[model samples]
Target chain A: MASIDIEAEIRAEPPARAPVQRVTLLAALSWFAAAAILLLWQDLTFQPLVRELALIWGAVGVALVALGLAGSRLGRVGRWTALRAPWLLAIGIGMAVWTVLTAKTGLLPQPFFPTPQALLEVFIYDWPKILHSASFSVWLLAKGFFFGALAGFAIGVGMGWSRAVSYWATPLLRYIGPLPATAWLPLAFFIFPTSGSASVFLIAFSTAFPVAVLTWSGIASVNRDYYEIARTLGASPLFLITRVAIPAALPHVFVGLFMGLSTSFAVLVVAEMLGVEAGLGWYLQWAQGWAAYANMYAALFVMAAMCSGLITLLFRIRDRVLVWQKGVVRW
Target chain B: MVASALKTVPQAAGTEINIQTVSHHFDLEGAPLPVLDDITFDIEPGSFVALLGPSGCGKSTLLRLIAGLDHPAQGQIQVAGEKVADPDPSRILVFQDPTLFPWRNVRANVALGLEAQGTLKSEGHRVDEAIRLVGLTGFDKAYPHQLSGGMAQRVALARALVNRPNVLLLDEPLGKLDSLTRMTMQTELVRLWQQSGLTAVLVTHDVEEALYLAQRVIVFGPRPARIVADLQVDLPYPRHRGDPRLAELRHQALGHLGLDSSW
Candidate 1:
């Protein structure tokens, strides 16, 4: 009744490759259009809507230039647009320089926060502070994730592997897993200082509990029939866990680990905001107290970039490791 | 339609095994639920026997008893002058479902029993030969999921045969296949039986199939099951469906089962 020709579907292939001319052409047209808009709009008034649009387009031009350069380096374009990187970079620099010149000539009103020169000055002057804060925060996050996820995964596997352990620990862990890390802030303050160690502990406490619970449930749900076959084949309990159970639970474990990573980052930021002296959260609070809104905005941008980049990195690792699930849609 | 028990013909002697007064019961809580009540039968070596019975009639329980998967609450079962205690490689049981490991391919599944017993290297030649014997010549790397029910059952047969078990216990191995596949599998099974000459005890409810495959069909009754009739099919190998002798024997077996009342 279940007649399926899997081979036929699998063996079919699409047609041969097309030229890169179309994509390169589109990129070139977009770059030129962005350049023209910037040159035309540099002298406009600084209305909130128009100013935001200009700033956003200005960033887009810069990004396009970088993308074009990188694509050319990777030999991604046609023969005509092979040298498009220099053209794009020239357009970007020309627009930015023209915008600065127009502002100097009093053609455009002053920016709300800073002139282009002032924004550069802030970036140059505060580079060291921003770098230090980001590095310190990232370090704490990594430390929390490494220790917490490892310990949680171990505990989960152990508890799930044994019925007695599950019976004893499940109740306690269930009660603790849902309690937010912020709820423990007061307790942590009394227990440890607002230093690096407390931040890490807060991050770990928030991340590890949920990760353990997920992992235990994941391992518990592994197919019992696989284990029976293993047992019938004379596999020891340890062998069964290592060979059959773990591989089957790996995708879920990775999901838990990723969730743990994000939670740790979030908890680190909040914990730093409490009283920590050196982190992105601390930097934001420090900037706001002094009414330096630009510095706060910049720190916020850096945090967003870091979180996005780290998530992409995690997904890349997952893709490479779990390549077997690529074509199959199990989840 | 109950024919009196026939004056038993003397069987050619070769390993005259005995299953003495075997009775099995399920002890659920404190109550005794009898499955097979005082089952006494003898299967001579190198003979094809069918334990024919309706569903829930303890045919499989009897087969399991012979396969050493379960113990009788009372009495003794002896094979080749030795008492049965536990499942051994010498006696293999093929279930109604193909219990092949999904992770392993056909050849690996077949070779598992040998590998588990740590005889793979020493018995590699025989494993290959058994795979060839079951007509699964090229399907070495085909996993169980990729196999059809009939093919998977064949792989199970190969697995059982590769171990060179003296007694083969089949618990409705072809029950899951379609009519065409079942017929082909039955033909293939008979061919293999003739070629290998292993003593096989197949449990089935289909009276016609029981007659077609087995040299002797042991009929059983339900509710504390026991043997009710033992019919012999004297027709030779490769028996036809419309063989008049088979038709008469089929009707006799059906009548004994009281299916004539339904018609």
Candidate 2:
């Protein structure tokens, strides 16, 4: 009798929840709405422009459906889509509505708000030039960020670890840290032979200050107990700094890296506008000079994408390196 | 039973500690705050001694001084006939908090001393042995945060033991554990001390704990700590908490602390 009761109780319990497998209805509806808007809207005078817009929308819808099917087969993909599909649908539909309003109905102004199709045209036509400029800008950013982060890390460690270093550097950092990178443009131009080196110097200087300050603070704030433990274990001064202090200060160093990256981008753009002829910032300036608003917008979009992509890459590296801090630190 | 774990490493002769006229003070915003005053004691090699005292009585400060993490303002501490000046792995101090580097795993924490001494390549096996000694063999890869309070304290013990320290100074190492774990660890500590044959000086306020573990108990007076009582316990190993002799020592220790022992 007891065995039967146990069996009945186990049977009565709820089953484990299976992952959602069916295609999301709302996502399908959103795609249909976008398609209808693309096809029914007849205000565009250019047939090729309308065809291009239709083709892009159709491709996106098909890709989303194919991804949803693949997601159902893969558990991780299914989980990702379950979390992100609604937001993706909202963005897709919102953009489709925006395109119809600005390009087809003429509800918003032309030239200032170029059609998405026109922007696509600019992207396709100016691919090589844009790619070349982007690569140059990236090269400049990599060099500046590398040297800047290295110098900052070394100086910051010295300042934090030694009283004499702190005494000397703190005053200098205070005087220079708050000044804009552009303030040194005149000095940088005078010091460097090429405008390229000048631009690199501007970016490097802007990046270095924040990295130095944050690294100093990070090293300073490491718990005194860690040092005590390491010292008792026969650790040398080098071991204490490298093994105990630096690892303890890494989270702070990452924060500095993030700050340095954003500042580098800002300085890079302004430095390019100064005199440099082959970068995204230069492309924007050239477009503005010719009053090619579409090309300027195109360059702006690429810059936004590139910056965000780099930030995401940095975050991925931080997550991998700082895996022990998984639950303790949310970001 | 726990002593079996200690047999993996051959025990070295314990070191003797001689602290003479040791006085220490900290500078608090330019004003001196005395912590220990003319504290003098001798710990024979391989003896288990417990320093029992009230809170804030400079017991931990005394431990730190013996560990050579700090120096006295007035006197000197000699370990194995050598004048103490700086921290050495031979006289390891286990803190109240485990203080394991959160970034490192259990094996790495145990390996720290060897790594610092640049002998990790030759002595790396000691880390694994230490982990096994603390009964944390399976948890060698676990981070400090993943362990319970008792488990973390065990890892800290392993970290100290891996150095094969002659003198183990414990600053209330098990004070943070629950009553049950504390009682268990007290026996474990006694077993390890016996097996390893290392001199240990424990600073704790728990009277029963001191009586159950240490052969000699040194009681301290309030602030500006001074030795008030030094009682010897001639008890057998694997002692029972309910033993009448241990209860008497507990009362005596409490009495020295100026606490009524009526309960």
Candidate 3:
């Protein structure tokens, strides 16, 4: 019988796996191809204007490659690049190629499809107006979101916890919840003193419905065992609701908040178009009337970035509060 | 630290438990299904009693009744001459699953009872002591998911122990653990019971576990559970697992449950 050498086995090193290189190579190739197209391809004879954007794109591609090479020493940033290099590269190249095809080559329609250069020009020239409109929209969104979330949360807990509340609220929710906020525009305008207040109401009404429904469902689905355990620990009904039920239902509450946020943004845009003097929605309509499609596109881009940024902020809050669900949930 | 911390908290003197003609039923699809039928028993203070029975024998239901999680449908249960009305921190039930709040870390989970009672500020030291007692000293910051099965159950034990309950009602607490962990935990349970001087009523289907831990074993029949046999093991503390007396008692308990002793 042969005796196994445990010491030697413990001292031995396992084989090292190779790093992912093919995707990195492909990502680099795509970036280079995009840069080459931007540099060599001439269609509309607009040289100086497109050159600046192309230079920026080319610099980004170079930086990405440099980051990938120095990834071993870069720690988290390097690892993140290694993981997301393919998608990042694809997006960069796809946007560049699409801009070249539509804006320079005129393969797509003009005015409707504004060049990236025109969009940039709009940002440079009309930045002050855009910023003013953005701030106004943000203020409206904040007021509406805060009040809607607060009221919805309270109503949801009540509806879920008490039979009497549910009995009355369920039917009301059923009747009012499914109706779109825009549908209530005519009534809201008459009901509220100002267009701004009417807009706020529309946004709030849209946001509250989803939040209330989700909160009700979330609270209803909390494990009975937790309640029993809390009760055994001498917890009051208030303690049970606040500490036990609320915390347990947080994951569901977050889902509700996310839905509410999206709907609120949609309502905000439409409500702003309802004779509101200042907001991204009002700006978009003004830009469209003047046939400045570049400004419209720029506004759309800003709205997209802002909405996504808000959602990201909410996700960060959820991750911090619901620490127990760390590895279980991911975007 | 353990000794001083233990001394600081008032020791929960075991309270006598009395059940008078207790019966319970569950409403399954609007039809009443009988669970426990006319069960009566008395548990002395500071004694360890094992409720040994077959699966679904309503032993857990009986334990829940004693814990005041539910009221007996027919009869009444009293603890130290006072009628059991609602669940109190004085009587803590440790379920089969560890049931530690996944949101709270080990230390916070242990502190839950005190926090609920609004005495957390004064009795906060007990949480650390309980964690130490359960041998989870280094895992104070660990979440329930981060801990192993045995560790989670240990945290659950610590959570209940922190409250210093006079009556610890265990409903198959070690039923989910691996054999090795279960055996080690059984020893730990006996040690905690001996040290604390609290009345313990354990519900388990494991014959060897009942034989190893309890001074007295109460056996119950299936379905509408009723006490079939009650036997006392006069063996001393730190009883050996391989002792002939334990094997004899195991045989007796198994025979009462209508199972063959020759496994």
Candidate 4:
């Protein structure tokens, strides 16, 4: 009977794993339709990007068809691609629709609203100029952010840790924190030696307020038990502040940094628009002056991507540092 | 296995604690609210004791006073003949919540007391020894959130034990664990106390917990906590839970806490 039971257990089949899917059939069909439309029809006006866009859509459709046929051998990328099938299909259809409306037919005006190729033309021809402006913007933002974050962190820690510091800083923060950084444009320009210096001060000013406010709250609201625990373990005042208070309040400090980044971005653009020599905002103004709206649109895309990429990076760093908090605490 | 890295402990026996007319109160909205009402007690060296009381009776507050985390409004607490003016690493307090720094892993958490005192450079091996003693040798890299409640509590014990404290102040250390874990830990606690020779003061509300582990059970009444009875258990180490004497002592303790003996 025991030998029979062993044989029966051995004969039982294992639980089936989920099947590996590539792309949805509809997604492959959507991209193929888009590619066919672009390759077959002649646009009313010649758009250089039309051929490039058609090739991209065609390649995606081919890859999806190949992946579906190959199954799991393609690995992780294939799995990821399968998850984004609906999004890929929607984007393909939207792109085809945009090409029809703008290039194939003169539905939108020319000077104000250009074809897809016109926007791509700025990157193709004027990349060097665009790169220079973006670099200048990055430099100014980096300098301002570094200084602002440092000063704000110090002041916030000071205020949170000491009652005397809180007493003096509270009134000033209440009075000045809410004023927009751009409001000081005229005065800052007059007071500072150069337009560059003035813009740097303005960006720093905007970044400082949010960072300081949120950091102060974070430190102040730290659980009292953390301090007590450290103190009971013979922690000095310095050790308590550095080890217990700061680490305990780190999640909130990250929140402050996030808010500071966005505010600094706004101030950077405004400061650049007002008087700075070269930046994305200056490029936008320069393009508008020549009525080159396509350049403006291209610069806007760069700005949105830059800001979004930084936000995503910050979140990734936070997840790594605060991994232990996944179960213990939630914001 | 490491051969007791804590062999450098200068004071092998536990320190004596004497609380003299200690009272404390909190200021609640411009009114004085009394919490501990003239509590007095003396604990012998290298003995296990429990301050058993109801939740709102301020037993934990008295523990805080003894640890010097807070000052008593009226009286003084002396440990080893010196008045406790501030918290010292030698008299470590382990809270009910494991309270392990969530940012730190087990090894780092156990090294905290030594790190804070700038002695971790020479005494770092004590961290591993404590971990091994707590039966968590392979979990040195696990964070507090990754551990179960009992495991986390064991980590807390290791963190305190690494300091080689003369007096261990336990504020309901096993209160949050499941019943099975609690019983097992009671045995573990007795074994640890016998091995280290450290004076242990545990504050708990469970009657059986007070009787099973502690040599002396100081029972307290409701809010504005006052000692109702101080019953001594003259039992040897490795006690049996089914022993009839524990049941009889349990009845006495329950009677002191205003519960009927029949129950």
Write the residue-wise lDDT of candidate 1 on A172-237 in tens digits.
788887788878877787788556777778888777886787788778888764554444444556
Over A112-195, each residue of candidate 3 has an lDDT whose tens digit, in order, gives: 887777777888789999999998999999898888888888889999899999999999999989999889988898989998
Residues B137-220 of candidate 1 have per-residue lDDT tens digits of 999977677788988899989887877777778899899899999999999888766665668889999887899999899899
- Docking level for model 4: medium
Candidate 2: DockQ? 0.75
- The candidates, ranked best first by DockQ, are 2, 4, 3, 1
Q: Report, in order, each candidate's fnat.
A: 0.09, 0.76, 0.72, 0.72
Better model by TM-score, 2 or 4? 2
Interface RMSD of 2: 0.8
Candidate 4 B-chain TM-score: 0.95
Instruction: Name the lDDT value of residue B214 in candidate 4.
Output: 94
Winning candidate number (DockQ): 2
On the 0 to 100 scale, the lDDT of residue B213 in model 1 is 93
Clashing residue pairs found in predicted model 1 = none
Write model 2 residue lDDT over A233-297, tens digit each, in one string.
99999999999999999889889989999999999999898868889999999989988788998
Q: Give candidate 1 regions above 4 Å deviation.
A: A1-31, A43-161, A181-232, A235-240, A244-265, A268-331, B1-34, B45-47, B61-92, B103-143, B158-167, B191-199, B235-239
Write down the lDDT that model 3 would get: 0.85
Instruction: Write down the worst ten-residue block by lDDT for model 2 chain B.
Output: B1-10
- Which regions of candidate 3 fall more than 4 Å away from where they truly are? A1-103, A328-331, B1-10, B260-263
lDDT of every predicted structure (CA atoms): 0.72, 0.85, 0.85, 0.84
- Candidate 1, A62: how far from true, in Å? 12
| All candidates: DockQ | 0.15, 0.75, 0.63, 0.65
What's the lDDT for residue B79 in model 2? Answer: 94
Q: What is the TM-score of chain B in candidate 3?
A: 0.95
